[model samples]
Target chain A: MISVRGVHKSFGGVHAVRGVTFEVGKGQVVGLLGANGAGKTTTIRMITGFLPPDTGSVAVAGHDTLRHSLAARAAVGYLPESAPAYSEMSVDGFLSFRGTLYGMRRRDRRNATERVLGLCDLHEVRRRRVGHLSKGFRQRVGLAAAMLHDPPVLILDEPSNGLDPKQIGQARRLIRELARDRTVLVSSHILPEVEQTCDRVIIMARGQIRVDADPKELLGSLREASPYIVEARGDAAESVLRAVPGVERVEVTSRPALDFDGTAWHTFRITAAAGAIDLREPIAATCAARGILIRELRREAPGLERVFLSLIEADEEGLPSPPGRGRWPADGRDGGGSPGGAAPQSHGAAA
Target chain B: MIPAASAIAVREYRSLFRVPVGWIVIALYLFLTGVVFVSSALIPGEPASLRYVFGISGWLLLPVMPAVSMRLFAEEFRSGTAEPLMTSPVSDASIVAGKYLGACLFLLTMLAPTLIYAVILAAVSDPAPDPGPILAGYLSLVLLGMLYLAVGTLVSSLTANQTLAFLGTFLFLLIALLLTGDMAARLPGNIGAILIRLGLSTRMEDFARGVIDTAHVVFFLSVSAWFLLLAFVAVESRRWR
Candidate 1:
């Protein structure tokens, strides 16, 4: 339902989006995943007809955004960044005004207003002024306003931006439900939110599309040196973990500040050799045969963050990243190094 | 187009009441106009005409209308609501028209309460006030208000800073009024004659004396349209950059 061909946009000297190209088919839930300033919002704005590309064209539902902007805009609903809505107006009043702008009849405006109010779970605050609501509620109010017209295409920029955790869950459910019959394109800097909600993820970095694939395909491409995160109650666990056949390196990540049970538990991050087979079983069998207690032994699952990070790292440091994996770090640097050992927490992420 | 413009107009008009700035502007304008009515026209043997109030009210609009219009686009852009609005399926003209008309309607409301001056004079004066000049005086103020607001709307569209929009509009109107009202009297015949015809304060005289001049009316409306057109172009320019 949306096609962008060689789109380039610049603001004075800063090139916001450069030579970006992608197409989103009908009924697909796609996420433009990126860090801040990755040109996701710029791309969405061009598609919504709020902006015109400097060198290329964006078409929505077969309507060129530059040549037939009104029709292109008419087919899509957009929620801009920060979820801006007129704070002076009530939710019901704002949604009705939105309907009127779309040329809906009085009865149709009322019905649509009611429908979106319910869809976004905003009926309780429908009569209150938008400025009087909390940030999460106001964000939902913006979402409600965008989908008010029931357009076939929905383009939301950071839709979960200001919502609380519960509200984010509700919004994810709503976006999934809405994408059942429409082409939905959402952008976010949150990695798991994209992984959890999007059917296909297009990871962008520095105004370029670095990676685009399904979540599973991204995970399946992790053939680099996979790490085994081990937590046990012993000092010898490190050497025991390193003694496994597939083990190449083992580093102690953390030790407890105080031990209530006489001995401190140490956390070990074990990097497996390339093309290792079922290291979890081998590590567990080795630890069990040696009489070293194994409190936890699990292989790290590759996440979109890993793929996303490596790609962005390649962009920054001229290194080869793996969606097709062969090489590890060229200098034997730490795989998950983020300066203070706060990195590798995503190993705790539920993939 | 009509529906979209009217919808935006109605929203703008009502929005002026929702914030403290809108109420403060209306209050200040009516208070100033009331003081003028009481001090000059309400006196016992003052010809029972609305000349004094209407004359100063035109000047009052120089400051007053900009306050009403400065937020028309600037506030939207500041709060980021312009994204949803400009991206909607409405044309640029309707958005500009709606905002301008909304401010005009506000000026009309602020002036409406002053109509009691006519009834007051009619009750007390031996000969009631001349209805023609009274009606003409109002027409003059309305046109002047519309013209000033168009200028304010154009200034508001150029930037997202309300204070800058307000100051830019006030200074521009002040310069225009000064050139046509003061400088026109000092210059030589040809330029002076042209300035006199173009001067809003001078043209208001024809209205106060109960003469409806078409050239003066057209000048006010056309210049207003020209400014609004500039505003529409300014609004459309946002898409390119």
Candidate 2:
């Protein structure tokens, strides 16, 4: 329902979003993951026709954002960052005003306002001034305003920013419910929230897309080359562990002089390659051939947090990112060694 | 577009009355106009007339009209609500027109209570007052308010700071009033005549004399429309930046 192509936007000398391109299809809840000032909000603004792209184009439901902004905007329900609303207005009043702006009929506006109020669980506070409502209620009111017109595309920036755990959970459920039929592009710095709510994730840093993939596949790929913790007691245990076939790097994490059975126990953390098979059997065979007595051995599943941090760290260091499984470059350009070597496609379908 | 603009205007109008500032503006305006009327227009021996009342209203409305229009767009920009309003399906022209109309309506409310002065004049006069000059005087008041409100609205769109908007609008109106009244007479021949013709005081004097010239009406409307259009352009420029 949204197509953004080769978009480049700069504010003064700051290149906020640079040559970014991505598409969100019908009924897909795509998470835009980035740190602060990573161009997520700028991209969302360009797509929603709030800010025009400097050198690219954005289309919503086939209407060009710049050329047919009114039609494009009519199809979008945008919840800007911090969920700003007319704080002086009541929740119901805000929804009704939004509905009217979307050109809803009187009866339809009332009905839609009622529906969103119920959906966002804002019925009890519908009559309260929005400024007087709690932060969670204010967020729900923003969500309700966005849903009031029932637009096909919803662009939400940091929908769960200040919510407590329970409110965040409620927000996640509300997004999931809304995503049943609508196209959603939500930007957030919170990794787990995005993981729980989005089907596919697009990670951006330095105003560029670093990785884009299905969350499960992205996490699974990290799991394949996961780290291992090994502790052994023997002569040259570190050397033996380093010589193992699948072990790419081994570091002596702890080498305390503990006299266990007249031998010093040592611990090492091992990192395996992407194609590493089960290192357990190979390590075991190698350790037994030597007189190394195994103390502790376990593999650590790479969490999303690790993957996110690694990607950001690589981006900060100017290293070629480990291409996310089924990833695509944000821009069609092949610079920065993005490993999804295939030619960039115009739109991404539901994975 | 008209419906959308009207919807915005209605919302703005409702919000104005919902807050005490709106009531305060109306009360302050009526109280000032009352003081002016009693001090200047209530001549014991003369015929009941509102000539002095309408004459001073143009200057009186200068400061009051800015207060009414200062928050039209500045508050929206400050509170970050302008994002949603702009992202909505309404056109820039519609938003400007809506806000201008809303402020004009509030100014109208401020002027509505001043009608009591006319009633008192009509009731107490030995000769029932000629409704022609009175009607013309009220028309002049409304037009002057419209023009000042439009100028204030334009200033409001220029910045997110309401104080700046108020001061900017106040200075502009004050200069306009000064140029047309006192300064115009000090200038040389053609310049003096031109300045006098452009000043609101000249047109208001004609209205007080019961001369309803279409030229003056057109001038007020065109100037108001000019400022409203400028406000629209100022607002739409945000998208480019």
Candidate 1 per-residue C-alpha lDDT over A173-198 given as tens digits, one digit per residue, 9 for 90 to 100 = 99999999999999887888888899
Residue range A144-243, candidate 2, lDDT tens digits: 8888889999999889876889889988998888889999998887888888899888877777776667777666656666678888886589899989
Instruction: Please identify model 2 stretches exceeding 4 Å from their true place.
Output: A230-240, A252-268, A280-297, A322-351
For residues B15-50, write the lDDT of model 1, one tens digit per residue: 999999888987898888888888888787668888
TM-score of chain B of each: 0.96, 0.95
Full-model lDDT, candidate 2? 0.83
Please give, for residues B127-239, the per-residue lDDT of candidate 2 as tens digits.
87788898999999999999999999999999999999999999999998899889999999899999898888778889998889999999999999999989988998889
Please report, in order, the local distance difference test score of every candidate based on alpha carbons: 0.84, 0.83
Worst 10 residues of 2 chain A by lDDT: A342-351
lDDT of 2 at A154: 94
TM-score for the first chain in candidate 1 comes to: 0.85
Error of 2 at B223 (Å): 0.4
